[model samples]
Target: MRIVGDGTRALNFFIDTLLVFLLAYAGFKTWNFYVMYWGYPAYNFGWFFFGILFVYYTFFELVFGRTPAKWFTYSKVVTAKGSRPALWQILVRSLVRLTIVDMFFIPFFGKPLHDKLSGTVLIEI
Candidate 1:
């Protein structure tokens, strides 16, 4: 399997981020609607977006070994040996993503912090 380049990785990130934002926004609006209906003040749930983001990556990666964005990019996550990663590896990957260090590491290090920590890599299908 060929390793994907930065361009494909960027596209995957953009699409996945968009999907996560949409999910968070939809859920936040639904909650706000109920709060308004109950005569309660609407409050910002900005922080919860990160929680949604975490779950989005974890659930998708665990279940399919890739996100929908990966499907579009024709790439999937695999270990160094080109096998599907373990559950702990996938969990570590999803969690480290929230730290946002991957953005800085990718250009210089040739891989993101999540991939490095999780022992995983994105490979072209």
Candidate 2:
């Protein structure tokens, strides 16, 4: 997690997904642990789950340039050089997190590349 915005990553590594995962887990529990026994079907629901997260973060980040979580943590998502990121940039970053990057090699590669490609960084504000 010691990437460019390492602090932000460290603090939010699990926080961002807490609600999503808890809800997914609770749903599995209510369904008689079917998902768990079935290898946690929610685990494979990449598109649906990440899509929801993307929409949430993208809309908010585009409008506010910072999600509530980032703001609460004294951070803001912005271009690497500290400019406000456009909607597409935010979407790119979120998509990278949702797909190729996070799904495969977390704390591995995508985080920094996302910052670079999206021209964004989660800065400590």
- Report model 1's TM-score to 2 decimal places: 0.91
TM-score of each: 0.91, 0.64
* Residue 78 error, candidate 2, Å: 1.2
Q: In model 1, which regions exceed 4 Å deviation?
A: 39-43
lDDT of 2: 0.64
Tens digit per residue, CA lDDT, model 2, 3-112:
23556675665666775565555544555566556555444444445656777677778898866667667777777667888768887887776655444443565555
What stretches of model 2 exceed 4 Å from their correct place? Answer: 1-5, 22-47, 100-111
User: Candidate 1 on 18-107: residue-level lDDT in tens?
Assistant: 999999899888888888788766767765578898899989988998999999999999999999889999989988989956778887
